[model samples]
Target: MQCISANAIFGYKKSAKDIHKLEIDDETAFIVEMIFDYALTGKNSIQIAKMLNEQQIKTPAWYKNKCDRRSYEVDSKTIWTSAKVMKIIRDQRYAGDMVGNVRATTKVAKNDNIRVDRKEWIIVENTHKGIVSKEIFRKVNEEIMPIKERSNVAVGESRRQGFCYCAYCGRLLQKENNPVNPYLFCVRQKYDVKNGCDEMKIMTIPLQATLSAMVVKYVSSLIELQTFVKRSKMKIFQNHKSAMTGDEIEKEILKLKQSTISLNQRYHEGRFTKEAYILQKDKIRIQIEELEDKKLQILNGIGDKEAQKEWEKELEEKIEKFKDRISFTESELAEVISRVDVYSQTEIRVKWRFMDFTAKATDYLVRAQKIAC
Candidate 1:
């Protein structure tokens, strides 16, 4: 039987140079482990850091700060900051990857850390044993980031965030609310635009509601199409029956015409009198007219089969686009839709994940209001 400490960091010890190595000290390893767990369990960085402080868990900065040597109250500020907790959680080191020079100093040789461009940073993957799975770490970051960003974001689902893009410049839109209403502004303009974004800002509620209405119509059209197809299939049998009857009538008319010719030939050959031949011809003419009338009665049922096939094919293709489509809620619009291009009130184009439901992008008058936001 062998025993091992839960805090063991596989290969090295507590030191500055050793920080980049696969090894970590017992205390730091435990802290990293706890932060990872807390993040997975929905604890934001602030909450995790506060919990750690309350538990009196010595931070990794204890050595640098000389907390024990100094006469400090050991409050939340002295112990750990939310940024420290987030940094630990964001570390690629736990995922068996190495990242270097994440922060650089200002040009004048100050110890202060400044954010460096991601392109300038060094990143190496699969360097050592990982404490947390990369998938878990990825999920934690994804979940935590949205939580942190939610205060400003109007509304979004976990799957729907970051799918939005500006209609004009194609920059992503960020959710925001004014005292009047919630809207999405072009992130380019919101953060950094050389001059300004020429794109129109989208009001979230009206835009979402309009999208949902368009999807509803799309879905309704599909249902109606399916019903029409069923009725059309039923009419197929009736059409075949009518066609057969028309063919039979045509054959009968041809036979009667032949008989009438034979009768005319008999009269010319003097095999029958003029009156008899005339009467016989008249009978055949009447029979032919009757058959033609019967054929005409069923003519409407006959249709262009090739044109019908094409129409059905087109409907089938449209139906295929919405196979997974369902009755959508307002929020679920984000699930099916990838993005929306607001050309104007009437010309809003919704690019769906499956396909564009608003194919025409018309019919904005869902209410008394002339158009959607």
Candidate 2:
């Protein structure tokens, strides 16, 4: 007989430097061990709950909380209230199996207790390392079977705290409300909390608006750059890749007219399906319209080349206008760039937006260069 410490498996803190130490399979085994330890400790759920809380251990809810900027807290009530623990014990994931579909329900109207039968179970086993010994696991399931109940909805504070950070101080913007106004203050200067900055609390709305305008401006510049590239490619297609020009349009029109006459003869001889004949006939009609349009454009080009050039020039002017307005958004600037740490008022260093945009732009230019050649 061998003994195992529960902490050795689940308690291994995953860090970047030691990420390769654990395999995914081993992690699942560890989770099962954690579950097993909780169930077999011979304590009722509430007693186990208190021990976890007293130790300041993180619960699943606290671990999953995205707004945890400063602290992680787990209430004992959450541990006693969760249905997931019971569900985990019943789950076959811990049993080293892919077992599923243990019950089927009847569709009876107006019955408060609709009938469900356990005969339809499809059990698959030996899928992974067992979380618990089969005998102990099975016994736990049987013991808890009589007390199974539906879960309760968890209640807690929904208002997000410490979400907004100060752009000036790089500290969490503490929330405050007044009858006249509401604001976020840098905890450092206001109350000397950890990582607090000495700057006065900043007003939220105008700062947010200024940042938003800046981001809008920046996006507009990028879009204008993309549009410039599009226009350049379109010019190449218009001048070099045109399918039907002056000489070509004349030849295409003659061919289309001949094809239309031949198709009409086949229709009259009942040599085509009605649908096929109509479809082919309509295609020829569209080809005729397209050929005519091309012919007219080519003929008019002799006199209207200057006007078309002016229209193209006007489009380029619009693209230029869009490039002039790119600005930084407050949220994006603060979050993405972090606060600019100023050691001196006169000396400043600017950090641009993420390298992602620059890399994308470089890749685009490389592809565009290839296309141009």
Q: Point out where model 1 deviates above 4 Å.
A: 1-20, 63-77, 105-113, 144-373
Query: What do the candidate models score in CA lDDT, each in turn?
Result: 0.59, 0.49
| lDDT of candidate 1 over 216-334, digit per residue (tens) | 77666666656755565565555455344667878988999888888888888999988888788888889888778656644532333464455556656756655565445645666
Model 2, span 148-177: residue lDDT tens: 321221112223343455444443455666
- Model 1 RMSD in angstroms: 22.4
Model 2 worst lDDT run, 10 consecutive residues = 1-10
For model 2, what is the error of residue 340's alpha carbon versus the real structure, in angstroms, after optimal superposition? 10
TM-score of each: 0.32, 0.29
